[model samples]
Target: MATPGFPPNTLDDEGCPLWISGLADDDPNHSVHVVRGLEPAAALEALGADPRLIQPCELPERKPDGWRASLPAAALGIEPELGDMTLLAGRVGEWTFVYDDAGATFGDVHVLSAAGRIAATSHFSINADASLTYYADGDELAWINVDDLDLETDPAEMPPELRAAFEAAGSVELDYLEPGEPDFDICMRVVSALAGMPWTLDDLRRIPLLVAPSHC
Candidate 1:
């Protein structure tokens, strides 16, 4: 949702905005959006958000690039439930959300697109606020961004089995942006570690993305 009073924003080094609004809850009616820069109290009034539904956490640091996440109690008449409810924001704004459900992840964060078919699961999702099930594709994307990873670098040093598997593909290459670069890099590193593991389909589908317990 877009609020009327926010100042201009600068995109992160990756050419992406500092924060984003994602459609998370399974219900079609409700959506959670993210805003960067403002404190929670002001954001609530801007969105007419309920005080009870928000789960605010300390931003890793003061990011000129924007680090705050503004999740609220409800959106477009919907509220958080057991299903998807992730939104990355730093403040409030007035662009009310609506969706068609073909949503997927963008810039490493889950995004609810404006149009598409709703599937049994999102096009992509990682272990998140609502659950721990991880996504191999998403995790692999994170690895692409590691500044230090190269073909010569050994994966066995960390989780040998997982790294080895990630490299198993004949043309395996670590060419991509750093995990969580420009934003959520902390979580990006954590999520990146999940790729190339000894996970079965069920395990990848079952385990949530894990980060440092302190962050959780």
Candidate 2:
């Protein structure tokens, strides 16, 4: 996907500010809606009130029994069952893993970095205690330490394109595609990679809808 330029603007709607847009639906004509803000509850409520406004679907309440069942195994080149692994979050220049029993045994690791540039890399089945691992620089390999601080909950200081993707995805509700689901993982990867890059809204207009890998 290409980068996004200007930030989104709030439109006036019945004395309140709303983010307005025309989204293509199953019908030939597009459907118009008012996107108020970023809260998940509000978004869901709006969809529930007018089902025709968005698509309907359901996602698992939590991570599934097998990691592969919850994520795209082939896309990341990881096995179905990760015996030991770590899930980390990162920001502009830092990251840290959230240790879990599943993560501790599967030895799988997913890394996201927005340091000088946007990059997403992953590794699997490494030694349980390995502190440093090989990362992907395009097709080549680079190394990075795993002990950096976590940045998942940090404020998203995203570039325009990244921010637009977030807004676009957030505006809809897809049940099988929850926040941490594998499909969402790919979305996050794309946004993180496009963050801080120079691009415009017109550029983002051409990005095709990313499909989730079916063989997870």
Best prediction by lDDT:
1
Worst 10 residues of 1 by lDDT: 207-216
Worst 10 residues of 2 by lDDT: 20-29
What is candidate 2's lDDT per residue for 112-167, written digit by digit as tens? Answer: 22122223222212232212222222221223222331224211544444334344
Each model's lDDT: 0.25, 0.24
